[model samples]
Target: MSETNRQWLLAKRPDGRPTEDCFEMVEREVPDPGPREVLVRTRYMSVDPYMRGRMRDAESYAEPWDVGEAMRAGVVGEVVESNSPRWEAGDVVNGNLRWADYAVADEDQLVPVDPDRAPISTALGVLGMPGRTAYFGLLDVGRPKPGDTVVVSGAAGAVGSVVGQIAKHAGCRVVGIAGADEKVHWLTGELGFDEAINYRETESVRGALAEACPDGIDVYYDNVGGPITDAAFAHLAVRARVVVCGQISLYNAEERPTGPRKLGELITKRARVEGVLVRDYVERYEEANERLAHWVADGVVQYRETVTEGLENAPDAFLGLFDGVNIGKQVVQVSDPEN
Candidate 1:
């Protein structure tokens, strides 16, 4: 085993869109595990839009990342040393761990990952947080009924892609809004969405949605807020459920956004809008994991990954999220197991 570990720290807070300048890397001796703790070598680290919000000093759903301190992310790793009865060397686990090649966690803070069930990398992607987020956010909050029209913004992303697929499984007519032409093809052609709109090519998203959703959108799964959300609000069906799973379009703004108030439109349409956090459904993660695993194995759901190699490039991979540079889950590959 290597004698040292390299970790990324928040060098400074971002005033707008984050840059690689905000991160600092440092080397430290790989510490041994304390009682009930395990030392892990990270294999994959996830870069999510929500992490951008954490860079701010202000409090939000997740705690803010303190400048100069080690930042944590969802990581899949192989245990190299252990001080707990439940774990041993060579066991693979997943958890919210340090953005480094090595980290130490209490055994309970990690979940055993079965490589035989699926690739270990999936514990940080499709079979992990994003998939579970889509499962509960759509089924519990969106509440789509069969034959309802379900439209998902940021539809080609990890969470959004899963949201559209789950909505289709519920027998809803699925329409996806994505930034690129290829993403539109994947959503409509491969994932089985009823229709897809390439937002960048269209002159007016609202006009495109109006033509596609002739009966009005019944379940609007919002991932990117802004003009697309504004357009979606304009086409809500009566009693439509709007599930706000993410707002990637607004995550980096330095100032609070002021846009047209669509509340009046919602009032007349009797639409319901609610925000979701995957952490709130922790008690039900097992259920989501089982079902999503089944769906993946059965070919009922599919996922894609955009991976950046090397831990040194974590910031670059993270910055890519805001640019819509990734078609599905964006993760950083830190190291291989047994390294």
Candidate 2:
């Protein structure tokens, strides 16, 4: 066992957009596993939009990361030491291991990963939280019916990409809104989206929606809420469903977002807007993972990941999410397990 392990700690709460000052790298002793616990050597760590909320001290669906604590994140790792009967050395697993080289996981937290099924890193992305989020949020909340027109914001992102693909698989016309033309091309050309609009180049998102969705939007899977969400709301047809999976546009906002000025339209259209937290559907994780894995295997679903090397670059990779720097899931390769 190594005498020391390195980790990134939250140095201070960011006033707005986080900078390098918000994080501090530290080295500490690697603790031994206790009864029913395992020591995991992290391989890959995920950087997500929801983590921005965890950086703030304000009330949210989840607790904020405490200052001076190891910054928490979803990680895929190999068990180097285990005291739990359910796990053994060399087994790959995924859990909330934080931003560290190694972490101790209790029996209740760790989930074993099968490398033969899919890349173990998928446990942090397409086949994990983001996939389940899209499944439950779209199917259970958005409820897209066959022949309906479904739209997704942040369409190139992990959750939003799956949402659009799943809607298309459900026999609906899926429209995607992404940040760049390349992403838009991938969404429509490769992912089978009915249409894709690059919000960055398009002058008016509302006009784009109106042009693309002549029948009107029946289901809206919103990942990057703000003016784009407002635009989608304006284009909603009667009895439309809106699933609010995340608000990346609002995550970095120092104050509350003021974009959706058309709430009255919701009442006029009798549309329903529901906010979703992936944790709410934890009971169905295995089922969702199984379905997602099958979809991946069948080539019914495709995904991409923007991976950055080294643990030291994690802060940069995290900040990249706010700027649309990632094409799909943003991941950081901390250390090669074989090394």
Q: Which candidate is the best by TM-score?
A: 1
Q: lDDT value for candidate 2?
A: 0.91
Question: Candidate 1, residue 25: CA error in Å?
Answer: 0.6
Worst 10 residues of 2 by lDDT: 251-260
Error of 1 at 23 (Å): 0.2
- Backbone collisions counted per model: 0, 0
Tens digits of per-residue lDDT for model 2 on 180-243? 9899999998899989999999999999999999989999998888889888988999999999
lDDT of 1 by residue, 44-100 (tens): 999999998889999799999899989999999999999999999999899999999
The list of candidate 1 runs beyond 4 A from truth reads: none
